[model samples]
Target: MSEDFKKKFDDVLNKIKRELDSIAKRIDEYLEKGEIYRAYRIWRDAVLDSLKMLRNALNTLGEEFKDIKFSEDDLNNIAKYTREGIREIVDKLEEIGNRIRELRGRGYLWIWFDLKPIKDLFQEVAEEVNVTMDGVLSHVEKFISSLEKAFEDTGRRASQVVSVRIKEKDLELIDRLVEVGIFRSRSEAVAFFTRRGIESSKDWIEKALEHAKKIKELQEAIRREIGGEEGEEDKENQGKP
Candidate 1:
């Protein structure tokens, strides 16, 4: 990976870590309230969703590190440990919440308070796992972007130029045609207007020559009008003499 990509990855990773911390903290607080199993169900769902994000982040890192020339042991370790740990904790929390619900229905007031501490423990563990996962994901995205750009640059450099040829007479005709707006320019006219088969015929060439003559006549007429205006001005000056 390039230095630029590394720097961007670090910055993004830090941000992800902070966001995960906030989410985990909120989850912890919600769990600690320990209302009924029905109330904690929403919290359970949220935690499950966050686990998906963590898993995705880990997968991205694994893929990114596969070809890199650095040690990814630490990353692999974190991902493996965090994924399993979070999954286990989530399962235990759900079980405890369910049990507390059963006890509450039986009029056992003690389970309600006991549930709160367990919820807090689950929340703290979640916070730590999420913070780490967030950082990893941000870096993964940055590295992927850099690799994509590098490959694109390589492709651009491999481009080759094409050769083209135009006859001198055809070139001159293109210029003349452009001057009269028959086409925008020689290249445009040749590219789009000139039919290869039709232009190859003597008849079509002759017709094009005729149009060229007509254009020359129009130019000459324009020149004569200017000359006639100048002559009129000269005569008017002589009349004053």
Candidate 2:
């Protein structure tokens, strides 16, 4: 009976490992093709399924091994690490989603852009998650280390919300820009225009300053020329007197 239970436990662990490998491969392939959204969908679903399977397997293992010398505390710690690891991956996915929204708002459809860097980032995260999951099934200490390594690879960034009110005409213009493929969405259009406007304002200010400087130099030159002419006339008048 103990042998049978141990065989089943090993089988479950092997199955989890296989599934994790499959999922990681799929994610890598998709990301390599620059299909970020598709990769994200796969990642989200695979993580959820893997978590469910992992939890079930852990529960079954604990029940079967209760009579054995296995420490319940160790099992509980494993479960905790698994949950926390999944949470961390999910949080990273959410951050990516938010960034997508932000890009769309700025009139950037990254779909048409070179996304190798972004894809690489996703691949890195997916690989990390897979490695961490494997460690969770094998050793708790390694699992923690893997998770921390993944987090360090992907540093954290702060974000904030901004509100703006646009006129109907401006909104229409944004739509037209999107229609013309200048942007992927209204948000993207708005973001693009806002950035362009800022750049244009800076340029205008620079040009204005240059013109003002030229005007000042011209005025000084005119004053000097006029003063020289007046001095010459006064000399002529003095000589005649």
Off by over 4 Å in 2: 1-7, 67-241
lDDT of 1 at 185: 40
lDDT of 2 by residue, 1-241 (tens): 3345445655765675566567667766754543444554565455446545646665565555555442334443444544454445445444443443343232221112122333343334334433332333444333334444443332211111122334456666556555544456565555555666534454654465566667778999999999999999999999994
The ten-residue window of minimal lDDT in model 1 covers 106-115
> Candidate 1, residues 137-227: lDDT per residue as tens digits?
4443343344334433422332111012345565566566566665654445555434463356547656776887887899999999999
Residue 85 error, candidate 2, Å: 13
Predicted structure with the largest TM-score when compared to the true one = 2
Position 196, candidate 2: lDDT: 68
lDDT agreement of model 2 with the native: 0.48
lDDT, candidate 1, residue 214?
89
TM for every model, in the order presented, reads 0.26, 0.31
Clash pairs (backbone) in predicted model 2: 104-188, 105-187, 105-188, 106-187, 106-188, 106-191, 107-188, 107-189
